[model samples]
Target: MRVQLILSEALSGLRRNASMVVSVVLVTFVSLTFVGAAMLMQMQIGKMRDYWVDRAQVAVFMCREGAATTTCTGGVANQEQLDAVREKLESPALAGIVRDIRFEDREQAYQNLLELEPDYADLVTADQLNETYWVNLVDPSQTDVIAEAFGGMDGVEEVRDQMQYLEPLFSALTVATYIAVGIAVLMLVAAVLLIATTIRLSAFARRRELGIMRLVGASNRFIQTPFILEGVFAALLGSLLAGGAVVAGMYFGVDRYLRERVPFVTTWVGMQDAWIVIPLLVVIGALLAALSAGFAIRRWLRA
Candidate 1:
């Protein structure tokens, strides 16, 4: 009997403030979607870091003809200078860290440059390219020490860490994730306010019935249960839709399009990740709605 009464009251409250309920649902849906997107982007960043960071190498670029670096003041690195630098890299000081070392002569470097940027291939000559020693370190975290050891050395123009090239990309994604989270937070606040407004309006519209119930010895808990349930049901519906949207994004958007296009990415988000995020979103939605309804009723529906 209590369950039926609560359900009927919740249904009546929802029907009474239909537009506000729709607003709450839509707001919660959009908010949770942002939350899901931010989470997925963070996951992608982690996967990319875990996969690619270990593959990163330190490139010790030798001086090229006409280069104007302080370390390259001796015109260009001669073959003797190049051999000396290679010997230093293979020295005992870097024994455990140096896993492999590959040399890129001017010709080979220029060819790689052309392959990377064919349109500008004819614009630059071979002498303009630097001879590079690609140093594969056992651990990527030792990149700074390697760079410091070789950067100011004779015949070396600069020591380039491959991770530098990847940092900006990951940083941009992190910023995007933060932006999504910010928007989600704002939208969630809007959802809460809308829920509170809807509950207030529902309570006001049914003031006469509540007054009769109060005269018949209805407790405050009994009166508040239906209003809280109404908000919880609406928010739950929105969260369910948001969860579905998140799963669809991961499957169709990330897995299908992104993974297929970027075949090199071995670690991609799957349904399991989506499933993990969905339940949390549902719980958050339900809590937001219930808390807002309870607060609104306590403030406005005082006997």
Candidate 2:
């Protein structure tokens, strides 16, 4: 009888204050959406780090104009130095880490450059082109070791891994992710406080009933159940809304936008990522709401 009464009262409160209920839910949903997006962005960074690590290019840029010795230091890699570098890269000590080595002469690099930007053809002539090695490592993680080994070598003016190119982009994403997550956290705390306030108002409205119950044989558990249930239900609804919004945002907007428009970000988050994030967010939302409501009720009970 007590359980049924509590459930009935909970339903009545929800129906009576539908607007407030909706407000609580909407706030929760928006808050959780931000949380989900933050998680997704973090995952996206992890994905990029993983994918690029395997494909990082080890570059061996030769020197400029020739000097006394055909050395590459401040000059282009001569035939002998280039050949020796290739042999060292192919050696057994490095073979496990060396995937494929391609040599691009000054002329080839210029031709490729001209192909990319014909208008710049007049800017740089093939004669001034510098020969470089496009070294593909078996694993990108080995970049530090390989780069250190060959960077200061006799013929190499500079050794650079293409992954260095992605540093700026990753750094930017990291900053954005942190900022977004921080904002989401601040908003979530606000939502929690609002929910507590709203639930407290509802409790105040039912103060007469609570007072009557206290005078009667009602236990603390009996009086608190309905309020707890109310908070739980509100949180659950909000989570569903937020989770759905996140999935839609990713599917129609993020996924399609990236896949069709920007090819680079596609590899960052796959379909699997969405599948994983949704359920996780839903769980988070439900738990957060229930806990918030429980805390609110306990606070009101003390009063």
Maximum-lDDT candidate:
1
After superposition, the stretches of candidate 2 with alpha carbons farther than 4 Å from their true spots are 1-3, 66-75, 266-268
Per-residue lDDT tens digits for candidate 1, residues 1-303, read 999999999998999888988998999999999988888888889988988887888999999888888989998998888988889889999998999999988899888888989997769999888889999888889998888888788889999999888899889989999999999999999999999988988998999999999999999999999999999999999999999999999889987899889886778878888888999999999999999999999888664
Off by over 4 Å in 1: 95-99, 119-121, 125-127, 260-268
Q: Candidate 2 on 1-303: residue-level lDDT in tens?
A: 867888998888787667888888888888888888888989989988888877778887777575334345446566788888888988999988888988888789988998889998878887676678788887777888887788667877777888878989999999998888888788778777777776788889999999999999788888887877787788788888877887788888776677788776547576678778888877876677667877888889897
| Per-candidate TM-score against the hidden true structure | 0.87, 0.89
Error of 1 at 149 (Å): 0.7
| lDDT for residue 200 in candidate 2, whole number 0-100 | 85
Quote the lDDT for 242 in model 1: 97
Q: Estimate the TM-score for candidate 2.
A: 0.89
